[model samples]
Target: MIIGIVGGILQGMEAVYLCKHAGYTSLVIDKNPKAPAMYLADRSETCDVLKEPERAKQIFSECDAVLPAVEDLEVLEFLDSAMKEVGKPFLFDLESYRTSCSKEKSNELMARLGTPIPQPWPECGFPIIVKPSSQSGSIGVSAVKNEEQRLRALEKVAKLNDTPIQQEFVSGKSVSIEVIGNGKTAKAYVTTEVVLDSNYDCKQVVCSSNILPEKDDKEFVEIGKALGEGIGLKALMDVEAIYTKKGLRVLEIDARIPSQTPACICAATGINLLEELVCSKLGKESGKVRKDGCAIYEHYVIRGSALYTCGEKEFSHVEAPEYIKDFWGADEAITDFKTGKYEWRATVIFTGKDYQDAVHKKKQFIKNAMDNCELEEYIDRTPEMV
Candidate 1:
């Protein structure tokens, strides 16, 4: 099948990767010809959908389905309308996306559903998280310990012309689960652990059978289902949460295709989310079963003589990366690495029999890179509070 993917950035890269795994032809469209995913797709077009709606519609008509791999509301709505006019299935939910885009709205929905979430600021005390309600990832987010820091964080959000959401800083294992729905019902997929860098951007995703305790894992699945059904989600969405000592506290929800976790989940479990979504649209099941496996997906940047474990933001700077198998010691990688290149980036994937086995392979990957590149140092940084 030919899948038309819009917006060739991080999420676009993700859609292209999934299409590759599912044996589907990917056609990536982006205004910038040099967008990272443009090179990775089977076909690519350089066009801004909002600027040229007719041209976008014409391109999408040739594909079996269209998927919007962007968070911009304007672009997404344009693609939604274009897909509708073209009479093709658009793998996105605009209404659910409207709700999920704002932390204020989604937080209210979760609260009404009795899903655990971090307490509101002032009520929960110092060391709070102040973030923009509409921004994705770690953009315009801050961990503030006092009134002064809180004010500064608020100013940062104001600069983006966005509302600020203040919540108590909930620290624990960061976990995520994806859900797919057909409006009436929904299904939750595997859970993955999210590791963040010092800037609070995701640096790694670890997927395994034991990401959460059995009871918590079940609860997490139920939470994902509740949120999905609560929003009447029609496409795909992911729920992120912190598995704290008290219980599971949901962080936020994004009613769109996510970048990192799904890739890791696919590597660990045989079930491909994109394939399942497509099957659901056709009133069919993918018939793919899950396996008790483990996988680690991590990003790294090589600058000068140092190899640094980096976040998605840093990795996004990758230019015309290629997909490589058996990259270094890892199973596969999407990287810009070339022989004798002093600067490059890679998103490496490692799959194994269990979590420990995956970690062993990950260590070996690092060692191989160090030896092959003759790197002086390997650095991994983490958030100070977490």
Candidate 2:
């Protein structure tokens, strides 16, 4: 099958990587000619869908399905209309996306559904999270401990012309689960632990059987189902939460294809989310069963003589990276690493039969990268409060 993926950045790279694993041909589209995913796809086109709707439609007409990897509402709306006119399945849900884009709306919806979430500020006291209601990732987000910092955080959100959402700073293991629905019913997939960098941006994903205790894991899946069905989701969406001693506290929802977690889940389990999404749209089943396995997906940047574990935001700047098998002792990697280059980046993935085995392999992979490059130090930073 040929899958047309729009917006070749982080999400685009994910779609292309999944397509390769599923044995599907990927056709990446982006206005930026040097977009990273453009180099990884089986085929690529440089065209802005909003600027040239007809051209975009023509390009997508050749593919079996079209998937938008962008968060821009205007661009996503254009592709939705263009794909419909071309008579191809567009893998997106505009209505659900609109709801998920605003934290206020989604938070209200989750509240109505009795989904556990961080308490609103003033009621929850100091050391809260203040962030823009409409921003994605760690943009315009701040962890404020007092009124002074709260005002600063609000000002930051105001600068973006977006509303601020302040909630109690929930701390625990950051977890994520993906759900797919057909507007009527939904199914939740594997649960993965999300590791964040000091910037509160995701730096790694660990997928294994024990990400959550059996009971909590089951509850997490149910929460995903409830949210997907609540929004009447028609495509794919991921629910991120903090698994605290009090239980799971949902952070936010994104009704779009995510990057790192899906790759880690695919490596650890036999299931392919993109393939499952496609099969569901076709009224069929992928028939792939989950396996008892473990996988670690992490990103790194080599600058000067030191190797630093970086976040997805930093890795997004990768230039013309290639997919390498057995990269630096890891199972596989998507990297821009070139011998003799003082600066480079890589997203390395490795799998094992269990969590301990995976951890051992991950350490070995890091050691290999440091030794092979003759690096002076290996640095891994984490958020101060998470």
Candidate 3:
């Protein structure tokens, strides 16, 4: 099967993982030739999706299914129509994407449905978060502790050409849930604990039964299903929130192929969101299969030289060692041979019954790999690393 993935950046990488596990070849399209996922795809093309959507559709027509991994409104709007025009399975919930793209609208809708979202501040007051209503990840996001910071944050949001949303900063652990829908109904299949590094980027995702407090699990799943149904979701989406003293409050939702959580879900629970969406699109019943285990997805890369890496020097430095059970979104480095600089992007998933068990396995695996390897802390260097 040829799955056409319509982005090649960091966010788009997740779709590639899903495609690979489903035993399908990926036809990756990205404007940047050096996009990380392009290195991992079976085939790739460089094109400005927003500018030349017709060209993109023509290429996508050759594929069995299409996955629009981009967040740009124009590109998404194009895919919504193009998918129908090409008569191919497009794994995108444009309705949910429409709702998710606007925090202001989605929040209001969720409120009507009695969903637990961060209340608007002035009502909730400071240490509130001032962020862009349309942006994802941490783009133009600020935690304002005082009136001065709030004013600055609002200004930053406006300057960035995004709507300003003042949200009560819920202090607690963060977790995310990935759901699949077909516009009429949805299911929250899996959840993962979001482990952010010091820089606030997701470091590793831990998928296990302990992802949410036992009490919050039902509520979390119900909220996720309701949110997707509320937005009239048509495909895969991610619901992110913080677990506070009370429970999980809906922070945000992204109705696209999410980057980290899907791999974690697949690695641990054996539930592949991409596979489910694709199968559903093909009108096939995706037999539910799962396992009880905690899984940790981590990557390694050194900035210095290629000789220290195991893969072919010309491509992404990846090695399928016996110790490494699975690989997802590993990209070969695009090198300027004259310069010593290179990046080896690879992810290894470690599984066990608990967090410590998974951590111990990861520690041992990394320790063994670190000796003959020049590994460094993985950092987010995507041009659009939001």
Computed on alpha carbons, the lDDT of every model, listed in order, comes to: 0.92, 0.93, 0.73
Say what the RMSD of model 3 is: 5.3
Clashing pairs in 2: none
lDDT of 3 by residue, 1-386 (tens): 89899887655566777777777888889897877678767889998877887898889889998888788888888888988899988888787788888889888888988999888889997889898988876778888999999899999999989989998999788889987887788888877888664445565677899777777988889999998888888888888989999788988888888877887787777788888988777767689687888887654444553222121111233322112233222211122222233534355677777778877876665555444355444233322221
Candidate 2 regions exceeding 4 Å error are 382-386
Order of all candidates by TM-score, from best down to worst? 2, 1, 3
Off by over 4 Å in 3: 50-54, 301-343, 374-386
TM-score of each candidate structure, all chains considered together: 0.97, 0.98, 0.85
lDDT of 3 at 34: 74
Worst 10 residues of 3 by lDDT: 306-315
- lDDT for 85 (candidate 2): 90
Q: Over all chains combined, what TM-score does candidate 2 have?
A: 0.98
Model 1 score (lDDT): 0.92
Model 1: what TM-score?
0.97
Q: Quick one: ranking by lDDT, best first?
A: 2, 1, 3
